[model samples]
Target: MAVTRQSVEQFDLDLSELHNDSTTVRFYGDYEEFEEPVQRRGKQTAAMRQGHSKDHRPDLKQLLYILTVSEDGGVPVYFTTDDGDKHDDQTHIPTWDLLKELTGRTDFLYIADCKLASSENLAHLHRQKGRFITILPKNRSEPRKMRQLLTDDPDCVSWKTLYEIRDEDGNLEHRFRTPREEEMTKDGYRLIWIHSLVKETTDEASRMKAIGKTTSELSRFRARLRSPRTLMRQRHRVQEEVEAILAKRPVGSFLSVEVIQEEEVTLKQATPGRRSKKTQYTKETKLRFDLSWKIDADALEVAKRSDGIFPLITNDSKLSAEDVLRAYKRQPIIEKRFSQLKTDSCVAPVYLKEVSRIESLLCVYFLALVIQTLIEREIRRAMDSSGIESVPLYPEGRACRRPTTRRLIDALSSLSHHRLQTDDGDTLSLYTQPTSLQSQLIKLMGLRPSSYGRKKN
Candidate 1:
């Protein structure tokens, strides 16, 4: 079952101890797969009104996923689904509401990617007394104007920042809002064009590669020459290939040939005594093979400046520019979480056939992720203490990382060993003491055996 409000409200009680006015919360979403199943348009497929299954590809719809995270890039899965309406934020309103409740705070940055960065989602965030930083969609017609208003114009340079704290009951809580800085951080966004950089980088790299290839060919031509005729043929071939370079297809598609059958083919003068005929087949076929080559150009170069780098849109006021950039980079953490949830967790191969059961399994995996995160955090803590401070027990966000919860729980279960006593009064070892991980978990959970003993009878 999807986690209910009660479950989130319970977590909020524990969360209250950790967060304060200086903290920032975030949320993000990513599309795991671009295409969804599309039903075959055949008359029979349509007439039956049957849906698609995992074994088949049907009318693929978009999966609008939602993830909420702490300031530290720890992701808490919120929602994942293919909304038939193709709506973005509205598709997960309940989940978002549950998140606010889970966080136990109304004023926090609910970071998300471009898709969830819709006007509706922003408005929803505002309506809930929350804030978010999201990369605006370049497709928005007025975004260029927004960018100019924020980054280009003289007035846009007049940016200001302020921090504030508010009293809630007896506790002092931080409430950061850039009602003015919204033009820059939360709402003000500029579309950065990297296409020029990409093109220039590509051109320079191509030129250098061409020069290297020509030099290499010349060296090979000079070295391969055994007789005067071989030298002439190699020289001529090099020049022809060099001239055709510009018009030639990419290296992967470059033409290569060997004459198979040609009656006019000239055999070596020495071979004339042994062979009456040497045939060369002239048949040719165009084939595109996958080839690997490196360009001396910087590997960081992109075909389009905007191809990989994303637009920086924000409304965060208190955070410095460096922090803002770092915050934006945390978007990918959600993606890794989604991937882990679906793959290692095997959430998709949900045994329950019912859709609700599938959703329930999604929730179970999400909780498992939470447990995994806590386990990793504790493991990292131990590793840090043991002087392996720079290392992680398990790679975080590793695509190939297995279900950490299973491994961690198994480790924990194995830690508290128990051995039965013999009947002959020979003492046998009983349960072993809790390991550092178990103790860390106990401390983490604030568990108390004494308190349990005092419970109502």
Candidate 2:
């Protein structure tokens, strides 16, 4: 809290907009003590139980690392550790309340993912006069209604370009459009639907890929059914296997499966010897199951209509659609902070078993993140002030417009200082000279070149 307040005062951070997001930090130990929250210094420690593992390692125990960063410079201002089994939607109200206490304001736009779009979370924030922007989860009926509206009358949505990006030659790379008339969610919060052309292409390609893979698997299954030595004979078992295949991928909505049953008759010699015309044989009937599938044209059409569509719900009616879109677009800034926490800071793979110690280590990691982001923000601010478009931070002297704190530290990692003591009791220190790029980086970070290798007090 002290560090965040100091940073906010020193940097004059724009607190009007804050982006919040969470990532899971997996632990490799039993963490039996943390199966339930442990009381430490009169506060409950986060339980490292299993939940939705963002790291895709559900077998390992984890703790949810929730971080909220200011829009200015993506500086992390508030963070907390949550029980691993707790759903994100349940954390928003408390997180928002903490932010309100921290910033002493309720009007800041608290942006997060679809988890923040829950009716309880949104209603709580709305009633408190708090503003927010978040993606509407696809499970919601609003998206389906919108898709149906679009399918029935394609001209109903009057789209205006909300955001776009273009290459140097002015060729459009990506474009986002929003309806001129903003819709409202069923809960009466403002709904801004965005359509992305790039996302549309991506969604279509992904659907085709999933469909192709699914069909390929089904075709192989069919071939197996045709084989004389195959064991897949039960209709229910074949249907279950087909359903599992479809469930493995998201193509179930676009494909239909039918289990075809066939009757086969075979003659077996009554005796164990080789078959012969004189030998009496018994005829047996067996049922065989085969699978056949085709794309559901109606479902495919409906999915296509909603390919690039996504909705954003917010309580602030005064903000323009473009502004709302822009705020939500910055949501990825918090994701970058998460990347730093996991990769650059190496906050995971914790060896500590004590929950309190783990929590303390996380606090240190949070402090490190703050300092790292501040350094990055300062360097970028300097670059902008000096009109320096790009720095030679990448290997092979490639220009990098936005330098990361990790890359900056890596650039200076090779610098070394040596000290020697002579027999006569005279001591001398030698320091490695900084490269021109290193010197420029040091200067940009507001440090004097002469003081590059000086020891800190």
Candidate 3:
């Protein structure tokens, strides 16, 4: 489907990250769930049950907004909450535990936004400390620790590290580290921050565009934190404040607190070498060289590029700033999964009610998504022109963004109605090929004849 391939490339499914080359993954999910209006005829009291407000067959119902996540991107994954209101006295699931359980494999790194930016999550991460990159919230006490790191003081310098790792082809991976500085802002929020990284986030072209500040994507990243919703909430509150201000002018004063952060990192380079960040383009266009050599042997360091930014907190000794940012950026993939389920899968615009039914459908939605993901990747890799003869069972471009549930169910499985003539003169539809879609669905179930009678001659 157009939807499936459009946004998923950002997920970073390269085989190198997988332990078994088929190992399961645990990443991140960002989504929102809203209430559906009840549709029913006028007041037999039936209309009231659907959440309709009017006696005239209620058309609308109460709305509950949900923001949730999933682990392993599969059916068995449980509904997870980052943070939300609790109607009853119920304990909510935490991100750390859910990840540990969903991924039987421990090699995966879990990524999340600021909601998981609590001391609890960080402490537990240090304990089990599986691998993670979480954005530190400004409210955290970390600012004190990094206080000396963010300054123009003469003593401030960059920290750097270099490692020798092999590529999938056994080739050497030239990796180096550097401190990253950024100023982040949105509608009503701003953060000054610094992070660490190695290598480029994308190819040379992308690197240049970001550097030139010509990329909308990068611009948005710098601007998205202060969402429109935050403004809306504040505006709504202000309306009430204005009413009070008008009723009793200056009787009481309201002060707005602006949380401003100044972040700087004093990178103490662990390595001794001249810094030459790999130059992107080659003079010949074919033969590329590390164009810029470390002009100064001093440790590679960068200062805050903008005024305010939020730093990504990490305890990973193995990954560099580049690695951390790249992993964090890849989080959009998990979000794409939700988009697929809602649009291509058509699961969100549902007709069901009752929290239990909604939950069950969520289960079905995830299962279908997993099948679609696997099928999609398999099809692309098992190219039709290979020594293998059969075409991909997944079939290329199956859905636009994601496959519809009905379409995906059909792709992963198929059903047939059969009737047999009996002495009782009865006929019934017989279903076949239950669980018929494994790696064998196409091999065993394709192109079968449907004739039951022999020639009368």
Candidate 4:
């Protein structure tokens, strides 16, 4: 572990900012066969247990995988396994300390998701003079206050556009923002609210679709109310049915429901047969129920005011809102590492039952991630330095401007070497020459072409 840390440090990659996240690696075997927290060589390690499976496989046992990566091209720097039952919030403190030790510094920025927003984690990092940025939890009072302010009078809160990125067609790709006024309190840290143009558009479209669906459903219910075979005989039943429909759909907030009652009178003859003197007309009153709904324009307006808004909390007052936004944006880099760890590497569904060996196997997987990241980083850097925009790494000679390590490995998968043995115990070796693309990739990666197959004497 020390040697690996030294190697990463030696590369001089950006250690100024680090991102952290966790996921679960599942196993199907009977992990219970081995005693958990078993002592091995005077050291105890936790065995597989059930937790909230990130892979959505709750039936299987798993180990919680905590990983941290540098913001420079998502190169993994630190990783550790935990008992599956542990929560992510509880792991952040230890992870921060481990990263501090690894980097031998305290001024670097630590970024993560909302799990790092807890008072304990934030307070601990602040006490140690370490800086961090993370998403604000919705349950916090500051966000509630902001939403209320925005809903009551949107102009009351001033906002400034932080930055914007555009696509090739001159379309807005994304934009970030923060409130122009100081949103911090004496007890609270710096709070920046971000608005995504894409999210706002999507939210509006989805809201309209849900409202339309609810309207159509209510029309059908109203038709049923007038039907003679309707089962909703009681007024409460009709109201309950309406509530159920609103609950299932996304239109509850913008919709209003009411049950209207009306009386119907019918006349009948006093006797079964018509009689001139003895017959008297009788009037019977029947109660009828109906439903009425309208879009709560006020509530809908309030929801619209807060669409596409997300908040971030940070203690570093020196960093501008854009800097914090950019740092927190790198949080997804760690997520990509988790993705490559699971999908590209196929690290799940372990075949081993022994818990000790499983832990060791995880270490090997971590090493593989490190090696793959190095190769990818090297190739990309070489491409940038040499003014190479794209490479033909895809199927049918398609171009890949930013190639992944998996695709690069697959491109070289067909190269092979053959060895023949004679009856007299003499041997001859033959190697297949690499294709132009393979040779180019090898050169970009600073590897010899002969490294793909047997070397010539």
Candidate 5:
């Protein structure tokens, strides 16, 4: 908290808009002590328990790292650790309250994921006269209603092109649109739905891939059922297997499975010798099961109709759909900070078992993120002020428009100073000469090249 306050005052950061998000840090080993919160320094440490692992390692225990950053330069302003089992929706109210206390205002637009759209969280923020923008979860009725509306009448919704993004070659990369008619959530909050051409194509392709995978797996399972050693002869077992296959993919709604049963009969001579009329025969019967599936054309068409659409809910009605989208788009800034925390800083694979020490280490990670973002912000600001578009920060003298802190560190990593003592007791000092690109990077960061290896007094 002190570091965040100092950063805001030192850098004159913008407090009008803040983005908040959380990520899980996975830890290995059996942390018996952390099965529950442990008290230290008169405060309980966050428990490292199993929960929804964003790292996709549910087998390993983890703790959630919640961070909020300023939109000015993606500088982290607030962070906290929570129990791994804690749900994202349950953390927003307390986080919002802390932001209010930290910023000394309630008007800052807090942006987050669908977890922030919960009724309890939104109502609390709204009641406190706070403004926020968040994605509406697909489970919500508003999205279902809009999808059904679109499915019924494809042209019912009037769309206005909000913006378009183009590549350097002037080719269209993405296009965004919103309905002309204003929509409101059931709770009376402004609900704006956005359509993206790129996202639509991506969603359609992903759905088809999943459906193809599901179909292939079902075909394999059908082939397995024919094997003589296969134990899946019962109809219920076959149905269960089908359910398990469908559960692994989101294409379950678009496919239907049926278990077909048939009876098999055999006749054998009782005396173990085949004789036509004199020998008695024994008959035995057994049941066999098979699986068949088909893709539901109607359901697939309905889902396709809603492919590119997503809803954004906001309590601030004065903000237009474009403004909401522009603000929400910056939500990835917090995600980028999280990426740096995990990947650049390597905050995961925590070797420490003590929750208090882990918390302290997370604090250090937060401080590191702050320093990194400050350096990045300063260099970018310098580049803009000097009218420079890009620098050779990439390998083989490739130009990099927006340089990251990791790249800066890599560029300066090879620099070193060596000292030698002669037999006559004379000391010599040698410093690695900075390359042109390195010198330019130093200048862009507002540092003097001559002071690169100097000792501080």
Candidate 6:
């Protein structure tokens, strides 16, 4: 941690804002019998237990891997491996405290997901004079209240325009708006509701697709209701099936269903294979259920009114809503570090049963992540300083704006050295010539040219 802090200072990273998030690393061994973490012999080991696996591998034992990265270049500053069952909300306090200790301050804006929005977490940070920006979970009444308020009387809420940006096609790509604060959250924090034109269009398209699919199924079901082969007779059963279909998607709110019940009478011959006078006819009465549905135009309109809206909560009153939103947007950079941990570093499939070895392996993974990010950051920074936009790292000289560490390694993979034994009992060394691209990249990374050459004794 000290070394990482030193490196952050050396690189002049933006310590003003840091992002924290966690991912689960799964193990594939028979860990059904393992000792819990104990302080035996002055040593501590991480516990392997089953928790929420972000990788969606609950069948395998896992350790919750938490990371804190700088927004400057997504460089990982600190990481911890916790018991698999550790909840995300439970991690923020310790992480914030550690970052405070490392950065020597508590004023850095901590950005995380909704897990950081709990009353305890927010209150703790606020009390410590720490600032944070996080999304308001939909389950919270605050968001619903704002949505309801807006729906009831559209004019009741006032909005301030943030900015407008155009896309490559010269069309409006995004327009951001935030509700002017006429009121504050019950917790005395700023609740800024943002409206996005892009999100609104995307949401509307998704709703239309879902509605079309549900309506088609309902239409087919209604047609089957009139068919003689239809066996769905109970009204409650029919309603249950229709509700299930609607529940499959979020289009149920715009739909209203009615189950229509009717009685059908049929005559059947009691005696089979018999003639006219000897046969007895029996009358049967059966109930049939049909359905009628229509789109609730009023409900649809109400929903449309709030389309493309999301709420952000922050305690830092000095920053505007747009700045808070932009800071929260950087939260995904930490996810990139997690991706590198899993993919580039391959920090999974623990073949060791001992918790000590697992803990050591996690430490090595963290070190590897730091090294990888450093190399990536250095190269990108060099490119920016040299006024270069893209590099030919792809096949057939394709351009890459942001070169990845894996690609850089692949570019240098073919460089090799060979030793030849002479008849005079002397050895000669030969090295493959570096490609122009390799030389360019090597120079950009500011490595000594001899770093890739054969060493002289």
The alpha-carbon lDDT assigned to residue 4 of candidate 5 equals: 82
RMSD list, candidates in order: 13.4, 2.4, 22.1, 5.1, 2.6, 3.4
Question: Which model is ahead, 4 or 6, in terms of lDDT?
Answer: 6
Order the candidate numbers by TM-score, best to worst: 2, 5, 6, 4, 1, 3
lDDT of 5: 0.90
Candidate with the greatest TM-score versus the true structure: 2
Summarize candidate 1's per-residue lDDT along 288-380 as a digit string, tens digits. 211122343332232222222234454445555445545555666555565566666655433342333334455566678775665555544
TM-score each candidate.
0.46, 0.94, 0.40, 0.82, 0.93, 0.87
lDDT of 1: 0.43
Who is ahead in TM-score, 2 or 5?
A: 2
Candidate 3 structure quality by residue, lDDT tens digits, 1-457: 1222222344433321211000011111221232222333431111112231212323333222222232323211333221122221122124345445544444456556665555555556567746656666655555533544554452353534433457899986554433434322221112324432223333323334333442232234224323433232233353453344324422111222222222223344345566456423322212111111111112112222211334666656677566665656565555555566656776644565443344445556655665566555444334332334443334573323332334435655444547777788886545454343333333332323232122134
TM-score of 3: 0.40
Note the Cα lDDT for every prediction shown.
0.43, 0.89, 0.39, 0.84, 0.90, 0.86
**lDDT tens digits, residues 273-342, model 4?**
8668778889987777788999988888778988888888888999888888888877887787788888
**Candidate 5 global Cα RMSD:** 2.6
| lDDT per residue as tens, model 2, 329-399 | 88899889988888898887787879889989999999999999999999999999999999988999899
> Model 1: residues >4 Å from true position, as ranges?
1-65, 73-85, 92-95, 127-129, 142-309, 382-387, 390-457
User: What alpha-carbon RMSD in Å does predicted model 2 have with respect to the real structure?
Assistant: 2.4
Number of backbone collisions per candidate: 25, 0, 26, 0, 0, 0
Instruction: Sort every candidate by lDDT, greatest first.
Output: 5, 2, 6, 4, 1, 3
What lDDT, from 0 to 1, does candidate 3 have? 0.39
Q: Where does candidate 4 stray beyond 4 Å?
A: 29-40, 205-251, 257-298, 450-457
Model 6, range 1-457, lDDT digits (tens) per residue?
8878778878787788899999998888767655367553588766778778799888877888889998888888888878888899999999999999989999999999999999999999999999999988988998898778878887777788888899799898789988766447789988888889889999878888889999999989888888998988888788888989899998877988888889999989987876587788899999998888888878878877778888888889899878987888789889888888888788877788777777778888988888888889999999999999989999999999999889999999988888899999999989877778988888989985456765546
